[model samples]
Target: MSKKKKIAILGCGWVGNALKTKMEEQGHEVNCLCRDINMDSLVGFYNCDALIIAVPPSDEYLDVIEDVYFSVSLNEAINTQMILLSSLSFYDNDKLIADAEELAKIKDENTVILRLGELMGYDRIAGENTAGKMTNDSTTNYVHRDDVIGVIEIIIDKNVRNKIFNVVAPIQSTKKEIFTQNSKKFNFKEPSFSNIIDKNNSYSSDILCDVLGYKFQKENVQDFWS
Candidate 1:
């Protein structure tokens, strides 16, 4: 019988833990790297084949680089392929990731950088104001955690080489839409949005689907919440 492909998950906090559980269930050897590895007894168990970096975004580029470095160090057993869970914020107006992008380019081969948008699952967007949530003015790109990790699995299965892939749902929603629908679902008052509000927007799942044949599971956020 063929052995299972090993996959490592770094920063197993929220999304990382979910990815680890999903990946392992498919019979892939899973290794999880965490900030508090000592506290968690299950640190260095499996022979990891691909390293999935599930850390969140930060304003500081150096911190991103540091986290990536730490993730790379954890894979001593295999020539672990690197998957950096970067953000669409990298493509923002400020371009805060200029330094990080340069670093990523240097080690492009055998690495896949997933530039995901605002993730919508659990506490990530739970606190948004449901009442008076603004919808039309500001637009945000969101993806379910399942879709995001699914894209990662595709990248691994296809042996997707060095490149950036945006793993987002097809539909875009404004804060008003999200909060208003959420409020209605929970039997609360409708939410509203302000004219001054600005949100990040992008095309969803095209590169992953059209190019890599990966499908995004979350079609819309409204379905997930409402």
Candidate 2:
């Protein structure tokens, strides 16, 4: 029988909470870190074994590292392994590699960094940056939230560690292709086509299945709706 591991999650919002519930369902003791002091009720649940950071992308995120908050949060459980839920936003084609590297520099060497791409959903972000820019002529990576959590579970089961990996669909699809697919499913107007790289930076990852043995839930990303 496998021993149950204790897990601590920082910034347990939508994705973080999902991970916590998933891990707990697998018999692991889970703890969460939140900004609010009223969350003290959760402190009794998790001491530490593995720390999973689910914070969003932001300039101030690096400040968490400088503060050694993660390292100190676990207190006596300092030897815990870490899984940083980072984003492709940090990958500014090596320009931000320094910051990216810093985020994974926990005290332990068993840390794994999973950098995700633009997630596609019908939620608020759907109408924001990506949805507005998607075109039949444009090709990009979009991973679903369910797929994101699934890949993480797969990694935990295999005990993959000490590397950087991209959690994206295998096939790249344009915005129009995805939207059209969704429109067909939901019966909406066929979105127009355009070519635009809104962000000044372009980031890409090559090692996912090569190192971690993680295949995304979907092969074709052509059906994603942003």
Candidate 3:
């Protein structure tokens, strides 16, 4: 059995809470931060074996980071090994890469950024609970939440740090393929689609599987819409 490590997750939203629960199940100690910026939390955060920053990027997110981790001494920031949950949609091209490269310097080299595609899982599939995008032939770039948490655990367990990895399923499918196969199970009408123009920033997980050896548990698109 792998040794248990203490982890401090700085966000307690849906993804954060789920990750915390999963990590706890695996025998790792987890501390979840749901309150506003607090120095006491940062003090505790600096002592963890690793940190997972799950807060989505927004106008004030940077400021929040400054309060939460960045404002601390460089030594303290260096001690906080982090796994940032980022979106692949933001870093999809050359120009975007140039911009994101600057944002990367905010954290120390020990931090790993896992860029996720559209999440698929209970109450979170593209075509269900609301609407879907992409055409019949447009390839779907998504991964289940279970796989996302799985990859995160792999990174922590294997000590994979200081890089960006796309946490998407290797399985490929069209929007219609997803809904058509699951229509009976989910009872959703076949939705229309449009030609998905941008593909440069589409999410995939070559580097992650290559580096960390994570096999996606929910590889099929139509396996879990219940």
Candidate 4:
């Protein structure tokens, strides 16, 4: 565990909120940037040891960073390390990937971007959304919430900067495959998958583990489905 330090998370939705609690349990102080725009949380962001941008990318994507620096970019204390929680949505679209890379460059060494895959863990599998989302051959990436927490913690500890890490499971499996294998555990019928698999957008998160020397506990989607 790292020394206790102030960690300001910009968005405190499901993932971020869970991360805050996990970090705090490990002894780090975390504060969510909620409604208090004028508070020191955002205005004096540099005061914190780390800042995490957990919002999803949208039309207002640029405004997120703009608003953060609108008040205190000029301050000498604006050297706090930042982590941007991005998604693998950048992979399928070349232009989207280019735009995300361009946007990350603006922050330079102070920013660390993580392109996460579909997050699965804590009974988030085999639900309403999983039964009919993809084909048998539609391979997709996924990352456990535990792995996400571990990656963020290590990045902060190692002071990883000016980098983009792909956070995902080592194996890419389709929804049909996932459900077919785990249907018995859930007492549900197995989903039939096609012999065809979508290979275009398939990704491997092996690089993060290789670079950071971290092991993923959630190797199979079936592990978290129950």
Candidate 5:
């Protein structure tokens, strides 16, 4: 077993809270920092072995990073490994990419960035949000909540750093395929596809698998209802 270490997760939302439970299950102490909590509380978690920033993108995100850096500096926790949970939007969204790059500047050699695909699992499924507004033929890039947690565990376990990985399932299914399957399984209304040919936004996780030697527990987004 890997040695137990102290971990801190900022932003205890869906992904962050789930990660906290998984880390605690593995016998590591976890500190959860939610948005409602004061940023000053970051001081207490600065000494942890790892600091995971899983907050979604927003105007307040950079402010959170600033506070975290200030607290880290005050505590002089130079060895604290930092991980930023970014999104695949970084491929097209300049602002989000800039935010991720800012986080990477914190500790170049000690930080890892994961640009996640569409987050799916539990209540968040394919075709639920974009129902009648999307093209049926466009390819999907999705990653399950379990796989996200799984990849983070491998990074912490192996002490992987100084890399940015695309955290997506290996499979690429079309919107029609996923929506059709989901409608049948979950009894949701099938999404209507537009006649317009939209650009495929498929992303690959080759670097993640190659570097970490990690296998996804939930490889198919179409099968991720639970």
Candidate 6:
């Protein structure tokens, strides 16, 4: 039997809440902390076996990290492994990319940073959400919510650390192709694409899979709607 762990998630939002439920189902004790909750609650939380920072990128996120670092430092006996949830969208913004770089420097040897691809699962269908808002010419770099949770569980179970991995599906499909499929399958409106090409590169999950020997449950973004 796998050893039970006490895990603390810093954000109880969509992704975080789902992860909490999964961990609980696996028999791990989980403590969820959100911005609305008292910060004092974190004092004891810092002593957990692992900490998953699922808070989205923002000034408030930085503040949360600063507080966590300070509290962790104070407790010399604490060796809580940290798993920072980042995103591939950061590549589109210089500031977000810089912020991700800065985060990698924190507890460098102990922190495992996961730069996830565009999240797609449940009600968050790439085709449906991107319809009428943007062009569908660029390649998609989506990762299912199940994969995200699975990767985290693998990391904690194997005690993986000091690594940076892109948590995206190995398959790359054009937005237009995915949208067209969704439109036929779900009766969604077909989205238009711009003639202007997107130069952004597609993200690869090779390192994540190669190292963890993990196989994505939902590898095709086109099938994400189902």
TM-score per candidate, chains pooled: 0.79, 0.74, 0.82, 0.84, 0.90, 0.90
Model 6 TM: 0.90
The lowest-lDDT stretch of 10 consecutive residues in candidate 2 is 124-133
| Model 4 pairs whose backbones collide | 137-197, 137-198
Q: Could you tell me how far off, in angstroms, the CA of residue 109 lies in candidate 6 after the best superposition?
A: 3.0
Poorest 10 consecutive residues by lDDT, candidate 5:
34-43
lDDT of each residue in 99-199, candidate 1, tens digit only = 56556656545567887777777655532544444444466677888788788877777767777878778876666666666665666667554567665
Question: How well does model 1 score by local distance difference test?
Answer: 0.67
TM-score of 3: 0.82
Q: Residue 87 deviation, candidate 1, in Å?
A: 0.8
Tens digits of per-residue lDDT for model 3, 136-159: 345677788889888888888888
What are the runs in model 2 whose C-alpha is more than 4 Å off? 36-46, 68-70, 73-78, 93-100, 106-109, 121-137, 195-206, 223-226
Worst 10 residues of 1 by lDDT: 38-47
Q: Per-residue alpha-carbon lDDT of model 2 for 1-226, expressed as tens digits? A: 2468877777787787778888888898877866543354245433466667777756766665444344455466445666777777655554444564565665545678888877764452322333334343545667777677777776666667787777777777555555656655665555566555344333344477676566666555654542
Cα displacement (angstroms), candidate 2, residue 78, comes to 4.6
lDDT of 5 at 205: 95
Residue lDDT tens for model 5, 164-205: 899999976887888878877777777777676568678999
In model 4, the worst 10-residue window by lDDT is: 127-136
